[model samples]
Target: MIRCSAQTLVALFILTNITATICCPQTCSCQSTPNVNVDCDHRSLTAIPPGVQAQTAKLDLSYNKITTLLPEAFNSLSQLKYLHLKNNAISVISSGAFHGLTSLEKLYLNYNDVITLPENVFSSLTRLKYLYLNDNAISMISSKAFTGLSNLYELTISYNEITSLPASVFHNLQNLHRLEMYKNKISSLPVTIFQTLDKLYALDLGGNNLTTFPFGIFNGLNNLNVLMLMRNKISSVPIEALRSLPSLQHLHMFNNLLTNVSALKDLQNLKTLKLDGNCIQVLQDGVFERLTKLRILYLQRCCIETVFPSTFRGLSSLLNLYLNNNELKTLPATLFDDVQNLKRLYLRHNELTSLPSNIFTGLPLEDLELDHNKLRHPPVILSLNELHYLSLSHNDLEIIPTTFPIQRLRFGS
Candidate 1:
């Protein structure tokens, strides 16, 4: 070994530092110019870089071990639009951490260990639109937690340990469109939970512990479109719970314990109905007689063993029908005679082995699935004039007429 020169040793040290600084931290990215993105993740940073100023448009600080914010860390980010801090070990975000980020739009803080945040933590994010706080340990949120998010469009707080919500949690969010609070331990919804949200479209409250229904929860939701009530223990609803919603389009009540549906026939604007995975083995003769605009119907994986023709006659505009993965062995030949606009039909994984020759008479079926059944050949429909897609996989098929698909197979066998 020979002694190295001073200049040579210094140059070697500089190269080593450059290699260690190749990947940036997740909490903040510092680029030579704000036009480009800088990734500063997994660096275990304690504070945001001091040089941060209103230049970066997108700053990703996700998946870090940051526990505190210096407040001044975001004083320079006036143009920041997207800020992602998901999968981080951060437990605290200073109330002023977003003080200067007025132009911020989307904020992601999922997969963090945050238990709670200051009520006004987001008070300065006036232009913020979307907020994601799923997969976190947040137990309770202050009423003003969303104080300054006036223009927010979507707010997802799913998969958290939240037990309750403040009535004013969405107090001033007038333009709010979609709100998802599923997969939480929430036991109740504030009577005025959505009172001020006039433009709200979709609201998801699945996978909760609510036993009784939330009455008048949607009293003033004039623009409500979709309401999901799946995977809950709810057994019944208030008489006018859903009838009050006129703009409602899609209503999902699957996997609940609702045995009687006398309250559903009044949903005239309802387009799609998913009532699968429930104890609803019997549908009152005219249970769906009023859902005339229904386009898609899914009753799969439920306790329904038989259906009356009148049960589906209400869905005259239905296009797709899924009744597979059930215990039904057969359906009457006239079961679907009323659905003139039907196109796609899935009846696979059933106990059916055959169908009458006129089983699919005069139907506009383009996609028909009868696979995984005890069948040997295709349904004996004389012709599928508008048929295009057919799935018959994994069946006990043994023979097919040579005249079938006179031309070579084009899509599937």
Candidate 2:
């Protein structure tokens, strides 16, 4: 009995070696040093390679010519945790194509020619955590397309041709945290489209053709932090559109058609606000009175010619301010009185003729640009003790002012 047991042990070792040799396909290279990783990327194959080892964990099939994903195409790869099929011509995915990949946690299907997704195509991948469908030509998605992916956290479908989505498309994605649908043709969204995404933190809808923001569309997103609405056609923002977001930190609404910013008075938790490239002509008083936590503010290229004295009264914690490329002829004396923490201030490319003597007193500015203006003398009359860089080029200054603090200055152009 002892001799028979030794022979059986030797036979089992031989069989294991044989299986490893035949498991790796001829068209791909497989490695077992760091737990079976396959590198089949850039292979111009038309179909999924056969004989992939069942123990393989990571598979890269990007930049391939594969056009179709038949049913159970990856059934042999039951242990696959990451699959890459990006930059492929894959236009069709039959139902149950990924039927056996229950452990798949990340799937990359970006930059494909896929135009539509059938229902139940990814129902078997229940453990998928990150799914990238960006840069695809997808225009239609079935309501049940993402039915079983309960553990998904990030879903990016940006840079597509999708014009609209079903109201119930994201109803089951309870754990989703980040949803990016930017650079699409989405003009309008249903009122209840984002009602179920309560845990979402960042939502980007920039570079779309949206004309108006549906009122109360963002009522339930209390935990949202970043909201990007740049490059849209939104002409006005109703007061109720952003009153519910208490946790919002960054709000980007640049490149729109906004003529007034009175709708942003309630977002007290805001840190950065971008309102550049709009049609705003004047800064109204108390428009930003409640934003005490504001740090960075951008209002460039808004065609402004006048600013009220109390426009920036409550921005005590402000650090960076941009007011370049405007039609301003003069500024109020106390326009920046409350912004004592300002470090970088851009007031270039304007039509200013003179500046107040005590305009920059008791402030710690690092970089100040006043170029391309109609100033006949140095703009800063008060001593900037911590000033390091200053630009006075392209101005009408006949001679440098004697009060200009150039002792500790680093650069002047």
Candidate 3:
């Protein structure tokens, strides 16, 4: 009986040892959804804790004071698929820091102090599809830093101090779709910088120091949809610069130094065009003759003083037009004749004193903004049967016309 009792105790001791090894770490909370998920976020821990199970699939370690990511920091979490390390003070990431995480698909390292990316820092993350390094101080990225991210679709490096990029930096990212590098100090790019990004759709390079549009820079981006170049120092946009972007729909070139826009006859698929805050003084006829698909046009604060009679000849699909904050003193009576689908017009902050009685005849206009102009009388809006919202405040109105269509108005503020 004593021998049998001793054997039973030994068996129990072995089982207890196995249980302790697979237990959750002391600083983290673990939940099992068939696969383990560990939450150690905001724990004030200085480093990754031990005793984490090997089957952990998701780990949250954000909002911490972790200073460095050692090579062996995540050596055991091989099954980790989603790792959140954002909002950390991480400044140094040792080589092979993510050595065994082969199944990692999404990684969040934004809002950190990482200044430089070592070559092959992400060599183990072959399946990584989404990587967020935005809101960091990353000034330099090695040409081979993204060596193993073959399937990456979205990469965001916005709000950084990166001044330039190697021409071959994005050569391997062929499957990348969206690239965000706005709010940086990038002044120029190699003409072949984006030669390999064939599947890219959206590119945002706003709020940079780019002074000129590099010709043929978008050569291989045949599927690009949205291109935002706002808040740059660009003075001219050559037609060759945008000739390859046939799939582009929304083009935002606002807040630049462009004096005039060349013919946009190639962008037949454009829907929204924003050229506000420029030095555009005149609108040449047929400048937008081919943009029949354009719906909304923003020309506010463009310093426009003269608009030709056929300035809006081919914009039959235009719904909203904004010409506020210009120096226009008069508009041609037939300026908006072809815009039969126009619903709203904004002509505020100009020096207009009068409008032709038939300026808006036979239209379905809904909203009209003529405020802050030098108008002495309300322009004839009797033909606008669908007019509901009108703003005539801050003008030089003297007498309120008794026959005005004020009954159909909903709000006039």
Candidate 3: residue 378 lDDT (0-100): 92
Per-candidate clashes come to 11, 0, 0
Worst 10 residues of 1 by lDDT: 1-10
Residue 18 CA displacement from its true place in model 2, Å: 12
The sequence of per-residue lDDT tens digits that candidate 1 reaches over residues 137-189 is 88979988998889999999999898898898898898899999899988778
Ranking by lDDT: 3, 2, 1
Q: Write the per-residue lDDT of candidate 2 for residues 1-413, one digit (tens) a residue.
A: 00100111224546443222324667787776656778788879898887777888999999999999998899978889999999999999888899999899999999999999777778899999999999999899888888998898999999999998888788888888899999999999988888888888999999999988788789789899999999999899989899989899999999999998999999999999999999899898767889999999999999988898888989989999999999999988888888889988999999999998778887889888899999998866356777888888889988886766677675556
TM of each candidate vs. truth:
0.83, 0.93, 0.92
Best by lDDT: 3
Q: Candidate 3 at 389: error in angstroms?
A: 0.7
lDDT tens per residue, model 3, 245-309: 88999999899999978745678889999999989999987788889999999999999999988
At residue 121, candidate 2 shows an lDDT of 75
Candidate 3 accuracy as lDDT: 0.88
TM-score result, candidate 1: 0.83
